[model samples]
Target: MSNSNRTPEEQALMTKAAAVLPGGSLGNLRLDEEHAFVVREGRGSRVIDVSGNEYIDYLLGSGPMVLGHAHPKVIAAATEAMMKGTTFFTQNAYAIELAERIVEAMPCAEQVRFVSSGSEATYNALKVARAFRKREKILKFEGGYHGSHDYSLMSLAPSGNTPFPQPEPSSAGIPRAIQDTVLVAPFNDLNAVEDLLDRYHDELAAVIVEPVQRTIAPQPGFLPGLRELTNRYGVLLVYDEVVTGFRLAYGGAQEYYNAVPDIAAIGKIVGGGFPLAAIVGRREIMESYDQGSVTPDVYVPQSGTLNGNPVAAAAGLATLEVLREPGTYEAYHARAATLRNTLQRLFDEAEIPAQVSGIDMMFDVFFTEHPIVDYRSTLVDKTLNRIFDNTLLDNGILKSPGKLYVGACHSDEDIERTIEVFRLGVAAVRDA
Candidate 1:
């Protein structure tokens, strides 16, 4: 755990933490010391580890810190709201403001319901879709993670070889029977989805997808085609914008594709590093929660203790304010494009079989010469991913263990520094 033989103090802390945690060992400290920057704090693109090692950060808390960690404005607003009131179970002015902001930001969001996390948001969206269609079956793309809920767990594997109209649970503890309620379709395979829908149209409730395909962006027009199919089939189209929201654009992926979903599940950057998420959709679909509904008994009951908690909403509002700023997105995204271009050029010059793909604030480095169009493509190589993992972390610059996200806080200088680190890391792996 410690660099030069573990100091007594370091040993004590490690032992204590290990005792309390299940995965006790520190597995992958990319930096040689293995103590690899624990982290005292972060500001802008740089993070100072507990050991006092500072490095430019591209991990960006998986993708939420678009404005970067602890932006002064976000911190101040959260602080002010915390001072006024951390939470008040009942509705408040702050909540209304946050809702208005989300509604304005999402072109398709006619109504918004706040929740504690992306999982909760997606779960509720699934429920809303089922209820609206008065059906039980939900369709989801392979390898699209829509949170850990049982229904969403089905069909996440890229292999369509799993039986038709159903799939085994991607994770244990999820009942195999739940798979019957989920229909699996490959990403970007419109023909496959059409066939599945034809078979299960009557029972199909919603078809959910991630526009950008996460690690790979969908080929152009793929999203529009999906939208058209869903509409024609009378199935509610749900967009899981958890990672793409605010990062792809202020209005999310929907804006870029010029297509709107019946329901949109949002989280990530909207929370500004806080725990907040929401399901925004058509008014009728969202209004099913209205008190004294015809079948209040049958209405979905989704509530969490921390749903719309004041502090998270305050942070979300502050985050949105920053995102809403004119030209803010342009400045940060330009930086990201530059980084991607530079990195791609570096890989090309090195003659590495690799390609990079992403939009706006998020990108993933894939070590494949072939175009990775979807999850199916991503499954082709395992060792290449391992090579990427080892090399990137071995250097001082830290990124997501897998997918990486750059933040608004990252400057031109930060991008250049990361490029240099990346070149060295790649060269190290090549030599090794």
Candidate 2:
């Protein structure tokens, strides 16, 4: 955990990385030099840094390592698949099998189309909706991340001066024309969504949302209300289930919440740590993808060279097979509940003004007294949150600054040790 122990080999790589890579880091995450680490290897619930320092991994490859790193079943499946061929650039049996699995498991997936990433899934989902409805605009919640695409980048981290439905571009490169197509509203606020849908329904193609936006779960009627509104307005309802897909339940959030959308995008655990994701929906909406199924005006063409690559499909199929086994979800939720409740109690006992948000599978504590329901509410104590996260890293727990993913592979011992580390993290926050 200390740089003093870093081997010359490790230090040399860091120097080389800095010379070749922008910001001396992968764009995914940046830690200060004192705490920066390059992952050497991962197995089960732990990751060993390049310097051989081990930490309890809570990032879980940013949420795809649900079965844990290099799971034997996943590895075996991928290896077996690789032996056959890596990529055919055409339809493969593994792709068909994985598509069948997704259609069977996901409530809204009557038909499934594969893509190479979650961003592609969302982007394509939007395209399909627009093609189907003959409308150009879509609504997304503020702070709800659909991925790094131009449309998704709007209002993702707005400073909050902008009013509802007005967009703020999170990144500079996004075209100015994109701002008009995306409308932003508060998460969990059904009224705002309804109002926007009412005004924009004629121009609105779909309403895309993360069922659980970041760490905030939807209030009881939120998702169902969205479904009702979208149906009434004749606009497609799209769930960006990239974070909640197979991780939430066997059927994902659509089944978990009993709120079926017209279409959905799924990724993360569905790929089993590989670069595979999908745009799935009703047969009618999904029909847009087939060049022969629709008129030229409405047809939406989508294809990725690596879409549904066999190795990823094999790993995904294996992961889903294991997930379907009885008691996997129950056991996963039980451990998650323990971690959630334990952290909340620790925060309370320490007299920290904290609100733990998110579902059991993934959540984080916001260092604030206010309830966390939207992006603006979460900014109440950025300084405190920043210190708390760094404390977690200092104590050897790797996690996203925004969320900590709990995996089925995390052992009882791992959870116990993590609790001890969580206490250390909370204490450091208290002292700071």
Off by over 4 Å in 2: none
Instruction: Write down the TM-score for model 1.
Output: 0.92
How do all models score by TM-score?
Answer: 0.92, 0.98
Clashing pairs in 2: none
Q: Taking the tens digit of each residue's C-alpha lDDT, what string does model 1 give over 192-294?
A: 8888877888999999888876776877778888888888888889999998888888899999678899999999888878999999998888877665663
lDDT (0 to 1) per candidate: 0.78, 0.90
Error of 1 at 112 (Å): 0.8
Which 10 consecutive residues of model 2 have the lowest summed lDDT? 379-388
Error of 2 at 284 (Å): 0.6
Top candidate by lDDT: 2
Give the candidate number with the greatest TM-score.
Answer: 2
For model 1, where is the 10-residue window of minimal lDDT?
A: 27-36
User: Deviation in angstroms for 255 in model 1?
Assistant: 0.9
